[model samples]
Target: MRHSQADTILQDSMAKRRIKEVTDAVTHESPVKKHLENLLENKVELEQVLAQNSNIDQLVKAAGRVQPNPVETITTIDGIHPVVKKKSGIKKSQIVYDNDYIDVDYDTKNQPFRHVEQDDCKIPNFANTWNAIVDMRQSKKAPVDTMGAHCCADETQDRPTYEYQTLVACMLSSQTKDSVTAAAMDTLKQRGLTIENIAKMPEEELDSLINKVGFHKTKAKHIKQATDIVIEKYGGRVPNTVEELVKLPGVGPKMANLVTQLAFKRINGIAVDLHVHRVANRLGWVKTKSPEETRIKLEELIPKKLWAEVNHLLVGFGQTMCVAAGPGCSTCAANKWCPVGRAAVGK
Candidate 1:
């Protein structure tokens, strides 16, 4: 087999091995220590499989600096070096959100669309809009209120599996509407949404399940890769911190922030989806164009106590009344205070 394909197979085998080792270690007196020792002891089993391949040395040499060692012995399959850099002038792939860290080449063709920078985003009575939205939402229900990622799965299930489902729902929700995301999650839950099940499922089948959601193909690949990492690196548990969660494939700052908030209940940052971005701008709460800018600005302005509720509140408002099309400025609760609302109504 080609080196790239073989490398993938090697990583998959080792990840499964690690999962089995973890399950076996749970019965031992020292679970953590026993898991580590068992992993080391059983790593040679991977080599025995690789040794059976007569062309294993060629595969190892051609593998370059990738996961699962790629060294001659192939015993330490999980030991990996940094990936070799691609040749210069290759257009770097773009990522979601206003990410400044990753070097994904956000070239013109692949660049994510940015929000239109408003000329005047400051409104004097903006403080009243928060109360207005809170009052307005109490009487009506929006799609986000009913079908958000928080409602995607049965949380009463096992902790690890439920957490993994939470992460998957967040990933699928990106660039997709809440209703679509909830539906997709429902289908996956029927088929089993656990990490081990998702990791082993063929990417084609997983993609077909979530096909209604936007960018299903990309999300499916990312879900599979992330499940493997969660098992191999995190012992089948989802990473709780923003820093670690963002390291997963297809997870950007937005998804990472939401995962930390919803899955882990660790309120570190606001998840600024399109609804949050539009609502923040329409209320004149933030002048920024992009969601990332909105998130950073909102973080500074909103109190820590309200951080968790901001996204849900604004997303509902934007999704229901303060829509992207002709908004209901006249009848809306914030019409009296919101600058955009007043402008729309010619007040």
Candidate 2:
């Protein structure tokens, strides 16, 4: 018997045994341990043969070829015999027998479909988010405070660049509300809110300025120290890289990436704040359980071209539409494309 004939017998027998094993595992209501024991016993003889003939050195060299092992039946059913037809101009009805088989086909164009495992962080839906946001912005359907609205801030001196302001504000915004951070920045700007002024201000005075924000005492110390470092090390300018920003006393990946995106126009980094992280996972854009994990995953799945805008869109979307604990998916623009929406609608 040729290898081709043997493969058919092996595959058919294996398929039947697999079906029986699965059925028994599911239907057996007795102790799970007993059912598992029976299943293991059923495969014991086959396992021994496989263990004995485990040398698969030939497989490595047999590229673009399919090989089948010997048939090992777990149960004997009547009227069933393992046989396969040859492919050398033989009719399909012509039967042959063997313990093993092989199939060699050189036509790569018509090869059977192959499935490959993807990395957990590789998300294909990320571009959809970018396209959706661009559409919403073009149609004037996005919120008033979306990142697109600040494109002119870099050119105009009246409004500080959102990235620079965002970094300072985020530093002050820690453990504090957004409203409070805005108010604190407003008050600080009255005293000539430059790096020099911030570095020279006494800790007590800086604390007074940001006292309205949360953790004002600790934040005040960080702000003063960070400003001093910026003046001394970065020459009165905040470093734009994530590595440099994270080295500051109070900055983390979120704040650093935000600074990178907002200040320097580095769009390859993603800022995964609570809002971005929550909405990403909730939307099944990324299945991570933590913000840090979500950030790493987003960096992998999101195309570099769209990385800068992902956090901005998700943050804005999370704020106005997908509120935590009560996401308004019904009225969301991306609702049609969102997996979460489909799950919610039972589709």
- What's model 2's lDDT at 43? 43
lDDT of each: 0.65, 0.53
Best by TM-score: 1
Over 26-110, each residue of candidate 2 has an lDDT whose tens digit, in order, gives 4222222222323333343223223433322221122112221212110111011224444332321343222111122211112
Stretches of candidate 2 off by over 4 Å are 1-166
Candidate 2 local distance difference test against the native: 0.53
In model 2, the clashing pairs are: 3-101
Candidate 1, 1-347: lDDT as tens digits: 34454455456756556545544434322222222333333443334334543443432333322222222111111011112233322111211222222121212112222221222123345456666777777678788877888778677789888788889999999867889999999999999788878988999999999999976887999999999999999999998766577678777667777776676666666778778988888777889855666777887676554666777777878888888654789889778777887887877
Q: After superposition, how far is residue 323 of candidate 2 from its true place, in Å?
A: 0.9
Against the true structure, whose lDDT is highest? 1
List runs of model 1 lying over 4 Å from the truth: 1-127
Against the correct fold, how does model 1 do in TM-score? Answer: 0.65
TM-score of 2: 0.56
